[model samples]
Target chain A: MSVLDRRRGEIGLGDVASALRSLRPADADDVASIAGVLGFGLRAADLNAQPAPTPAIYDHQRPLTPQRPQQTPSHERLPGWAMPPLLPAPEPLPDDVLPSQIFRESPLAGGGEERPAWLGEAYRLLPQERATPLRHALLPARTARGVLVAALATWRTGSEIDVTELTRLLAEQRMPQRLPSLPVATLERGCQLLLDFSDSMVPWWEDLRELAQQAIAVLGDDLVSAYEFAGTPAEAQRWDVERERLVAWRPEAERPILVATDFGIRGTPSLRHGGAEWRAFVARCVSVGAPLLFFVPWSRGYWPSHLGLHPQIVHWHPATSAAMLRRQRGLSRRVAR
Target chain B: MSHYTPRNFTLPADYCFRGDPRDPAESAADPYIFSREAVIAVDVALATGRPLLVAGPPGCGKSRLAETMAAVLRWNFVYQTITSRTRLEQLTVEVDHLRRLNDAHLAARSTSPHALADRDEEYYHPGIFWWAFDAHSARRRGLPESVARPRSEPRFPGVERKPPDEAREGTVLLLDEIDKAEPDLPNDLLEPLDRGSFGLPDGRTLRAQDGAQRLTVITTNRERELPPAFVRRCVTLLLAEPAREALVAIAAVRAPQAEKTLVEKVADRIEALRQELDESGRRPPGTSEFLDAVNTCQQLRIAVDSPDWEETWQQIELVTLRKPMVTEDERSRPA
Candidate 1:
């Protein structure tokens, strides 16, 4: 019992009323407890008599008298009437029959709804697998698209009329200007998704898949071109969704390249990745004017320093958000506001 | 720059919104009782000319606020529900290429080609923003002496605007369910919303008249997170689930012919159902559903204590109050 209940014997109605008369807002709970204690000392006539409320949620308006189900079926009560069964009864299985044998004989037969009460003990607790977003996410799902949009979006001339340009055209021609297009900023140029499937990245395979999905979800399937490589990006193979085939990977000029890699760390010794082959690959990207971005799961310490700023490396970590990317680009800090 | 400073408009604190219930318009709203704080938010938005971004669950009368406010203020009302494919140009303005092309073809075919006034004003189609800014200019497609005929002003079916008199012509633009739009849609509206003006293809800026007053109200179900830039610019009002007393008051106003006892009984049931549904992590029955239940009881004459009404009442609960909610489906399932 609460300590408030222990003080019930000493407290009286006048004491409770006096406590409430000067009750400060802060001490309201104490006064409430005191008033609750005074309720115990009330007579039957002191409190007005009231009927109990109907049970809520179900049967709130149920009839007063208890109604029971009919003991006999209508067909049984009717002497001359007969009704056909809707569903055929299943043949009973013997207790000695093995579960495997039963399954082999009747593979489609699942458990019926009318199971024995004791069978409830046989049921195992199946814990639910909840899909928590961004648990294993390298790039935070909410901010992933924002980061890409800020990073790779380019300006292209649009077919819509530009008032400023139209004004100039009309002034020069000395007449009413017809429709003229203007420059519009958008993410029209799609990106290449190069995924690392080396032995070192086995633990982060799911993350790679999630990264691809997030990229696709942001840009769209047609925009996110897919490529897969075991250890070396130079030897990467581009896969097509429709033809179900793989082709040699090459960097498209002016198209941003997003690579999910670890720079060949913890791979087999024979696999010569992140070496001269990687440098040549970087050189090819530079030649083609492709803006390469590495979504490396490893920290900056693991990245090769010899690449010389040709490709930008974004730490593929949970802490990586659009704000971090913006800050990295020397943009205005949101915290300053 | 402020719309309120130069105007004679004043929103009384004691004002209660009594909309026409008998009108069967699509945006027809019953009497709305604003929470004490909601009225303050409305005042803030009104005084500052900022869009009141009302965030609430579906069917909590967020959309109806604009229509009712239109009636109360005697301002022009423009209603448009946003979808995923909604473009910013469609809201502000768009050039009628087809109409312009047809005009050009007719001018070329006629002997006196100059007879067809091939002007930019004739090809311009003013959108909701244009109408809200200056209704008169918008009717003529933003040109006073345009050769094209004036267009009909947009309005709800049964809403009759108070005839222009001493009060200046103003507008209430309702962009309902804005969260359904693409993420950039809100950000794209920053300029037009802040300045009360948008650039036209005809090299003219269609600006809000200095003498006219305007208030924009946007409602969202929060299906997507709005950009912070967009949210910060607008005054926000979050509509909470009404308390029991408020619910009863709503029912009394919405269904004035409904019996008091029946309304009370239905309100009590709604309270219990709301509690259970909230506990189960589901959206509770909102104000719209409450009115529906009360109306069902009054129309069918289903008494809470009547044994004959038991099955019918249960069926009503199944369909109206709880059918689609996941937890509600569990109760009537086979044992």
Candidate 2:
């Protein structure tokens, strides 16, 4: 049979050969030229019906919409936001207590009864007297995934915390459930709760702030830090001003950590400005050595004991998760050694 | 477009690669989102012509991104959707029975010793990969058919006198939902992706354009990580959930008639639900769920805030959060 009838399916060696033979000399030359570039060529068709031309692989598609300009939400527009004024900053913790503390915790200190029952036994076996809280929670990595693991630690710290376990805990805590059902109002409520907690009603907030400052001292200005907040437009504006102030004072060499506090209910979704603006906040933190943290309400169910950032993220852990606490103790011991 | 036949399968028209479709109010203000990250990823894949792995929770727009890539490249995108049952032979052409019969007849009638000597070589049928390969080869040769015919055609248009040895320059191949396939399925692509040729079970290897061929994009839902050996052959891109406002903007575009507040509310709810699932160690709902959920609400004319439709609305939410898995589980369960 001729090459045409010898062809298999709509496309085959015989069909290709026949089509190539049928092509005009120019077409054949074109194929030859392309083949030359690709280091191959089509076999010439024996019969005269022109071979089908090869399809073009790359075609132009309509360009996506250009990125929106960076918007700085007005202070009035920010939702229930508030920012600590840029003043004489309190001294952060010693270097031993910062990122280095991640490795010092007790791996065998804690476990959730349902998720991980081993921690209870581990806590019992440990020499440390303060092992009660350590027995209940797992490390962030042992429980969470994604951004939540890293983000969670910044939200709440257990009696003992490890930084790297944040992402896993956040992932475990926020996945499929909290994120999908989270309401805008609820987010706002969470932010309000955070701000309200700081109003001196809760001794825990003060103690936590002191510990945070101590940790910040240990890590230095280069530590990457992240925070999550909820609030109304007014609160968002307050945060905007505070964030701007922090950016203005930040040294060029010491990058600022990302502070992912909400702007308002209706303001910019993601806003970045300056090497220090709210937008580039996360990247700046990465440049430094801090873990980004978020502050939300206990009720929001998103208090990730950890948050996961990019590969470069240095997660912080809290006392809530047992695994993190144990790791923290281990690291502390190592530093003492 | 005319050369391809009308097929029952087509991607949704209003597909957006980023953000939520169920909520509009929050998203309307920033309706246009140019994902520099995603765009750069597509560019990198095109430049290197390497397979891309996109992983994320559901509704992160992994599949839509593939479609968007096809559109942007202006290529005749062909998605070879795979399931658990898919085999390598299905992608590689199997031996054709009709061709085998013709070969046998010819073998019996062959009077010449030379023709009879090669009887075993003629028993194969050209498979889909070969069809795509040959068609791509013809198009690179500047054949008129390549420009006009989409991939849906029954017969790849235009016959030639000989098989073309040249490979096409820019054909785009989308391996959709590859996670649904066997875990080892990715290994099947290693040789073809790297060498530009696939070996058949019969021992014949088909080479497209000798080595230069189409751009291949593989998508996964991150159900499991592929073996490192296979992953080394590809560039990886991880997709994250967009913020609520971004989703709202997408919703406005897809559901223009819906009230903005209503859209925002829905998006918020969906986001909350997803996070909750994540927190609970459950798989979050995907972008498809968000779209279908909104469509369901619209069809029933139910207000998102109304308490009367709470049960139905919750069901819709659950459906989105747990799709094919729950459905399949239900089917397999004993009554």
Candidate 3:
């Protein structure tokens, strides 16, 4: 047991109060005032002798007895199915940490004015063979640099930069203008630097880890980022197990497994179903771990605010996807622990 | 300085190759050498402007074929010897100390109030590909671009000596042993090869703009696959070892004094040995090897029937072989 717990166990509440009362002044003028307040010759020990109040008990049977017969409506205002009880006023959500504070602290956010970040960092561990195809795809498109810069910023700030804002910044930078017609080793190196910094420093953010798992569900474990899980020491041990499960459980290769959220009714009007069913689906998503988020549909209200009201649900952006978030979350847990 | 100038080479009056480019019929004495048909096919490709990738085993005369093309076309021969250290700038001119000094001198001379100095012209040594394009254009057109001088404006003043019109007329650029160039070097050629134009370091482009075409012949040992982008741009032709008759023709060329019986015997034996190697999936000696053996006998003055022929043959074989000898164990493995 802790020191505070043990010490508090030995002291009685009355004794502590009595001791506190005794510490008060015994000045000549205060004696009359003390007498007036305490009555006659009441001692500090007597003040401390008061008993604690007893809590009231609630009767379970009292609410069941119905007594209002005078206001009986004709045929109970037409027989009808009872409406579900209204939900209690929701507790206000805890204010999220400010984006500015998050951005300032995160190492993923890069500094162009300063020295290049991730210069000395080890990139996120991935299979070396992937460097080629990734380069091939990324080089010709010239989108790799922007994605990498954002990833670097993600590492720098240790927070998720709003992808929209990041994309905007990249457009303004016109990074592609200065680059070779085809991105080459320089682009590859930039990507490596970003991965290295993120892997060594920020690791996976919580939302991203959850998304990764959901992604794994939709895209098979053969996907490049799937192997990223093996980088962490703890996850490394589970790599084989997870890999084997995924391979065995992988859906038909011809068909992509769709993993979008219901967000209440917006995703499918016909599949409205029950709130209980939604809760169950959410629980399954949490257990499945990656990428799956339970959300209230836009039909109910828009995104973060809608998802935020439900303590059990999370907002999964369409672009970010749930499976990726799960894997990132998994990575984040490994980093945090 | 030399007697032969840009106008010395002229297209042969009788162009036989164009008439029958695909015919497999060979030169009567040497079937192993390219049939006149093959030569014509290459010529047609050249005329139509195609970059030919000559691929074959080592010593199959792929490199020599380019030399022959240069000769036949009567174009100036320019060679770039590539090594591991070869880089992008080596293939294209970049800012160097010489260029910088020239720039500084031009800036100073143009601005100085105390009468401008007539400075020595800067001769930017052009790369093999660029130089061929530039020099060839200059020779055919007579320095039209070179004659038009800029006024040496205060901002971005013109240098006294223009970049060398190193572009030679009808230069057949032979990129020999192209496999040796660094990975990214070939990709750099795409622009110049595609458009027949390249930009200079000074933000000016030198074009073969309706000038004599620069014939480019690239030879490779097929060490590795070139990038698909580069490969797609070239006319690919693969060459194999020449036949026994071709070998004899090659021998006759190399050793004119050697008896016909000796030459035939050597050719037959070499052909048999090469067949055995091929059946066993082993690398065989090239036509160069056969020529080497014949040259050795001629040099040593040994009779073909002499008992010492075997001993002398072994000694000659060692020097003649370019590729590593395939061991029996390696030959036994399925290709």
Candidate 4:
């Protein structure tokens, strides 16, 4: 598996599979192969060595010009001159002789199956559906949980390594003034899950709940601060675990915020979540150094243009994965020039 | 460029991956049966310098291949299971700032002679890459012989997975579940894996002393896509799910104590269950589940044509093969 072999996605099977060379017929007898491919039935030469021989389909085929099989339609067919003439016009009977127009009954009328009494309700009622775990889900719960973890989780410095202060101390030969910094990927700073519960998001209400659960599952129950808001995300209120009451969502420095919203796509104009509010929320998060991620149910084209580039937006879809998220965030390695 | 075969790297026909005995006495499984394709893949990876990327559904024996290779070769094994939080620095080298600070404090106090004699090299914590590349250098923590070694030795990954007390030929490094890490991790790994060296913060390079003897085997559940660049640097192998015949053969090796009839029955059931699950868009049970079913039947004295066969098999199927991901909302769904 050399670099070029992998790069081109081809292997040199010809070098190893000697049987392939044996497949070639002796003395350039490739006409059979070509004939077979071209749908030309085998010639007498192809079956020369066979003990039992069968005629090819073409050998049994009849001519396109009139032949025995087709002679009936070609010769016995009726001509225009020999065809029967049109029927004479029917004579109209006297008014008294025929039954009155209104009195004559239509034979087709009143001949039908009786509509059953229960049929109406049956038509109105839906069929009893069996439960399915995967049907109509934004993503598989397991993969969703992983993606949520990958997208929302932020890294914090480990307690150990404070290289700058250490370097200063080592150079200047002074007492320690700061803690050492050993940066380890962690969710210690926690995350704020802002779920959109507005009218537009009604269809995905269950999905919103699932998303909340996924976020909490990834970033522990204690660390995740979930909030619910209708129109504007910035005006969200969360049930504060400490206060035992709902509190307005405030950006905490170093804490990441994950928003799962549709940007009020299907709601009334008045109920739509304003882009300005999202922009403000993102601005506030940026000001406080809180990372923000938006998991939108809509495709990129349907997303609001005004949200700006600050909040990383992810497609809330089953196909959306950590690799796609990395590409979006410009975190993946430099791929192509 | 030479032709490699099973003859070059054949396991002792009885080499199986059995579970360790617990407090309660339980019958052990038979030897692991090696697939020809898997063996060929290992040989190719060994011949080539590129890392071997093994991918399959869970318990399809992805990681076991690496361990088997390690055991066969009698190499130093170092493995690391990746999580969402795994980073490139964790796999390479990291500076111990606290230790450096402690050393500085002790040197100032003039009480600890160990701290006084310590150099910048003593503060470096060599990660698995350093250990696999050159154990001697990692042991010394990149310090010269004149400098005293660090008080604590660097920790090696997969110490338990390493075969016990044998002359080591080379290293077999296993990075298990690289897919579990964030997407950037694969990309971050490309340079270090390509060069077999990683850069230190103090502008020094820790590299592989001898490249040919070392084998890097990375496994994935394919939970997510890895960077193409990272994949390009690997000899990729996708282990196909085994067939009915394969299942039976695996059972023969994995559950040697079980009767052939019993193993065949379980294999037949597994084959049916695999089709059923695949048709339903669910992941089918792999070899581990197969062994569990056969072992369960053997221990409980369940025969192929036993009384209440259907009912007993149904119960076993529910516990072993059928693992449906049912949410509370979907609990009422018909199976």
Best candidate (score: TM-score): 4
After best superposition, candidate 3 residue B193: deviation in angstroms? 0.8
State the lDDT of candidate 2 residue by residue for A262-284, as single tens digits.
22212222322122233344444
Tens-digit lDDT string for candidate 4 (B172-207) = 889998867755677788766776778886888776
Model 4 chain B: weakest 10-residue lDDT segment is: B21-30
Q: How many residue pairs clash per model? A: 0, 166, 61, 11
Model 3 CAPRI rating: incorrect
Q: What does candidate 3's lDDT look like per residue over B1-335, in tens digits? A: 11111122233332211211222243111212454323432543353355766667778877666555555544456666554345555555433334444466666787644332223212233465555666533232222355543223111110011222674346567777665554456777777766666666555666664566566777766543355566545545556577887777766655678878777877876787786655433457887777777776777787778988778766665566424444546544432
How far residue B234's Cα lies from its native spot in candidate 2, in Å, is 0.7
State residue A25's C-alpha deviation in candidate 4, in Å.
Answer: 23
Error of 3 at A144 (Å): 18
Docking tier of model 2: it is incorrect
- The runs of at least 3 residues in candidate 1 whose Cα sits more than 4 Å from the true structure, single-residue gaps closed, are A1-145, A148-296, A299-337, B1-15, B20-29, B106-117, B146-160, B163-165, B325-335
Per-prediction fnat values? 0.00, 0.00, 0.00, 0.00
* Model 4 per-residue lDDT at B4: 22
Superposed model 2: Cα runs more than 4 Å off: A1-337, B1-34, B97-128, B136-169, B200-205, B210-213, B305-312, B318-335
Report the lDDT tens digits of candidate 1 across residue range A1-337: 4423322122234544553453321344433432432332221011111111111111112222122122235335211111111233357788796556333454766577577788768776788897676455666656776877655555666657676876887689765545666766465576887887665776676677666665554454447676667667877665332222345678898898888888778634444445787788888898998877788887776777777566777887877877777566443223222
Root-mean-square deviation of each candidate, in angstroms? 22.3, 28.2, 39.3, 22.3
